[model samples]
Target: MTEQNVRRRGGGKRKRQRGRGEQAMVPDAEFTSYYGRPVVKASPWQADIPAYLFLGGLAGGSSLLAAGADLAGLPRQRRSARLVASGAIAGSLFALIHDLGRPARFHHMLRVAKVTSPMSVGTWILSAYGPFNALATGGELLGLMPDPVRRSRPGRMLGVAGRPGGIVAALIAPAVASYTAVLLTDTATPSWHAAKRELPFVFVGSAAAASGGMGLVAGPLDESGPARNMAVGGAVLELGASRIMQHSMGIAAEPLRQGTAGTLHTAATALTATGALGAVAVRRSRIASALSGLALTAGSACTRFAMFHAGQASAHDPRYTVVPQRERRDRESSPT
Candidate 1:
């Protein structure tokens, strides 16, 4: 029977309306199933993953900055960088472990590494990076001990022992900062997977902003010129990348503007902008530096959350998946 006739003749249930034919296919509208059931499984990630992303970026960038500071003979900045790197990694590890639900099982994550697995590779990176950051921070901490204690043999040894580890970590830090985008892109979520090309840039910028902000607060204001510059540059870069992603995604970007994801995105943008402005406008004021640094740190965290939540929202919306695939298939099968 014709769809119209079926609709007019009888209802499927005693009291409910009968189903109707789908709307005509059009450039502006796409069809979805009842209740808009998700087209793919939701990500297994939780709060931990977003937190991990933020902390990892901060740690990675700080490690690089620390290495640079070491070479430049900026002892104070170097020490602060190492401490920030160590603390961020420690928090990242905790969040990761929390996400896993079973801390012991984390060992299995690195049983063997494969090129196909980003998580496994990341596990190895963390395993190597963690020790370096810890040792470097430990060395710095040892130097902070009282004069008598610092002169002790153990203290003297501790002060120099982490230099090599610090160097190695710096070399690996960029990958640690940027690989997170790859991990997100490798997933099936339409929003994240589709924006793979730009996500890495966005993440790298965020890392620089976060790490730079830390440097601003952790070290003397007089020596924070580099930190200020990095913060402003990174924030602008991230903001641009984020806008590019939104435009490139077309209709799929809806999730980024809806519900919880929308709130996070708005917050990230505002904080990043204000923080960046403050960093530049009040360069010599320690109070302004501290506030700007805090703002950027918060903004960086929000960036992770917004992206993750948007990915989930996109996955949860069947139209995002179905429409994009349909368009791709139609284009591929069309006559040349």
Candidate 2:
């Protein structure tokens, strides 16, 4: 055939193939790991960890309130706060040791102080804070004894020392309330790590809510001013921080919005809001104060549990791991 005739023949063959719908096969890809396995292992943690977190925060925040009440000369409120601080710290220590499977494991952690390690620093914080809180509470209890015992030289010395001890504990309280957030965010878990910037705020705010709630429950209306203020401020901070974290985390926050985690978070928000409103609206009613305090404390517990479960959910799901990394890479490669 001639050259032009041959070219026409090739074009006709291509047209025929196109008409037959021949095309490349591009199988749709899914966000998954090899063999559909999880991208990361779920932490070997239980509900005890969340309990420990909540108790530790409660202890820390209560220590701060106790110091403030002492300085303000609100003896009744100071006593209540100191008692709560000591009890919560004890419970926190117990929960942590239970999670570690042995008491010795917790003590072993204090052998060395590592600046880069959140767990190590948290252990030291607890060690220092716990004793001071206990001493302060002891002094408060001593003062409650009959006049004869309270007037004893040893009792007077202890009471004198407790103010300084509690002041030292208050100094370390912020770290106690926030270090758990640092520890969680430092992990490879997608939801927890993505919330690095706001988690500490959420935690500290929850701590304040818990302690303030306790104060409202135990303190009289005349001395509940600080507690009311703390509860309201803490409620605002916790709710705002949670919203910011969810908005900023993108896909990583999905775990927090779905399943059991979502339900808990919703409950926490409602309870905290209601408690804050009740605190402001019914300051004269002891019944209202007790109810509000209970709500706030419950809300704080729910928040901790929600965060714990969300981190586990994100770690178990490959999509939460893969999608964010891919998006990050795309953003890096895109033109500015």
Candidate 3:
């Protein structure tokens, strides 16, 4: 009787253990932040920062074009490009200062040189580029003025310094155009950090497109060939890099394809494509060239704003930060 009871009890205990194991299945935990707060804070940057990004790229590209036009002996195009560069740089500085809330903040940024800090590098780049751009523009303006003013000592000095200044600025133009991409990617924002490899190409291409558009709008039709080429090449680079980045970024790319960012990016892609085509297809028509330039300019601006908003969106959403990290960990842990 005792042996039978002991066997029955053992079988019942084993059955209960199996049942408990089957019923204990837990649902996967949804990715959620502590107290429903965002895992990462969205950057405090305002619209001014995006404006600065666009204007900075525009200025950098224009400086490069101006240097090229100078060497090509296209005086009209050079003049127009220098003017655009100067104006764009000034606007960029204003936007940056405005966002910083004080001119002193910008001055403070210049107090140190840190290779590891994108912002520091960018500030120095701007400093080096700005004076040269100003000198070039001053010379261009002096040339446009009356002979009396152009012959003055100060005017002559600026005019003499202009070409060399433009060449120097051109050397630094690539950094100016692309450093913002590095700055954004260095941040903890999921989308920006994820697309680090492609974002710089996108920024550089956008800069070129914007500069080419300016050339088309303001330069003589006879001298617009270089501008047309830049517009086309830039359009290709921006569109291609953007597509690759979004495709490779996994969940981080969702912000780029949805909501306000998506809408802006769509408009940017369409406008850039249309403008590039127009720059080539209607190269002989002044009216068409101007229209194409306008489209490219608008498109470049949209791209910057799109990226900024996309980063903010990704930072605000917990999943964009958490899921990619978990996936990466799982991949690293998995057997080869």
Candidate 1 Cα deviation (angstroms), residue 109: 1.2
What would the per-residue lDDT of candidate 1 be over residues 1-336, giving only the tens digit for each residue?
665654434422223345954443224344455555666878988888999999999999999888888887788988898999998988988999999999876898888988788888888888988877777888888887899888898877777777887898999999889989999999989999888889999999999898888888897787787778778899999999989988988787889898999999999999999999999999878989989988998899999999999999888778888888988999999999
Q: RMSDs, each prediction?
A: 4.9, 7.3, 6.9
- Model 1 TM: 0.88
lDDT of 3 at 184: 97
**Per-candidate total of colliding backbone pairs:** 0, 0, 0
Q: lDDT scores for all predictions?
A: 0.86, 0.89, 0.91
Per-candidate TM equals: 0.88, 0.92, 0.93
**Residue 68, model 3, lDDT:** 91
Task: Give the Å shift of residue 138 in candidate 2.
Answer: 1.1
Off by over 4 Å in 1: 1-36, 147-149
Compared with the true structure, what per-residue lDDT tens digits does model 2 show for residues 1-336?
554564443422222264667433334455566676799888899999999999999988888998989899898998899888888988988989989998899989988999899999999988888888777887888887898888899888888888888899899999999999999999999999999999999999999998999899988789998888888889889999989989999999999888999999999999999998898899899999989998998999999999999999999998888889999999999999
lDDT score at residue 296, model 1, on the 0-100 scale: 91
Best candidate per lDDT, number? 3
Clashing pairs in 3: none
Candidate 2 error regions (>4 Å):
1-24
